[model samples]
Target: MIQRDHIHMLIQINPRQSVAKVVNLLKGGSSRVIRTEYPEIEEFLWGDSFWGDGYFVESIGNKNETVMRQYIR
Candidate 1:
C-alpha cells in the first residue's frame, strides 16, 4: 500500500508454493476486487489489467525479521 503505483509487502508463503503463483493470485484477486468496487479506477488502468505484468520478488532467506520489517517500512 504505497499509493497506486507500487506495493511493499512481506508475506510468508508455504515452502511448496512458488513465488510467481502467489504473486499472480494476489494481483489477480486484488485487480478483480478493485474493478468491482471502484469503477473510477478503470479510467486509470486503460487496459484489461489493473496492475502491470511486471513484479519484483525477493527471498528473505536467513535475513533478520526485524531488519526486513524495517526495510519494508
Candidate 2:
C-alpha cells in the first residue's frame, strides 16, 4: 500500500537472504530508478540519499502471516 510518505509491502523472500540485503536492494534499486526517471526529486532529498538510514522490520515466523498482512494493508 502507498501512503503520502511511506509504503507498506508484504514480501516473501528466500530464507537464505538477509533482511538487510533485501532492504538495501529494494532501496538502492528504487532510488536509482526514481532519481533517473524523475530528477526533480533531488530538491526534496537530503544530500545523496533517497531513503532513510534506518528501516523497521518484523519477523512473523510461521503463525502471524495473516495478522501481519492485515496490519500492513
Candidate 3:
C-alpha cells in the first residue's frame, strides 16, 4: 500500500455504503490508531471532515495519481 510519494490500498468496501459513514469510520479509526501508535500525529489529524463529501471510486480499473489526488481532495 506504499507508493513513492503516496500509497494506494485496494479496499473493497460495500458499493451501497454511504460515503459519509465510510469516511467517518475511516477518519475516526485512523486517528485512534495513529494516536495509539504515536501521539505526535494527533494535532495534524484533527479536522472537521478530512474526507470530501463525494468520492471517486474505481471498481474496474486502476486509478491514476491525478484521479486519486482529486478523490482525496
**Largest TM-score belongs to which candidate?**
1
Q: What is the TM-score of each candidate against the true structure?
A: 0.88, 0.82, 0.46
List candidate 1 stretches off by more than 4 Å: none
Steric collisions counted per model: 0, 0, 0
Order by lDDT, highest first: 2, 1, 3
Please identify model 3 stretches exceeding 4 Å from their true place.
3-6, 42-56, 61-73
lDDT of 3 by residue, 1-73 (tens): 4444444444557779976687678757875786789866546644753333454445645657667556554
Root-mean-square deviation of every model:
1.3, 1.6, 6.7
lDDT values, one for every candidate = 0.87, 0.88, 0.58
Encode model 1's per-residue lDDT on 4-71: one tens digit a residue: 57998999999899989999999999888988899898887667888888999888899998899998
Question: Which pairs of residues collide in candidate 3?
Answer: none
Residue 37 Cα positional deviation in candidate 1, in Å, after optimal superposition: 1.5
lDDT of 2 by residue, 1-73 (tens): 7788787888988899999999999999999999999999999987989988888876778868888889888
Give per-residue lDDT, candidate 1, residue 21. 90
Q: Which ten residues in a row have the lowest lDDT in candidate 1?
A: 1-10
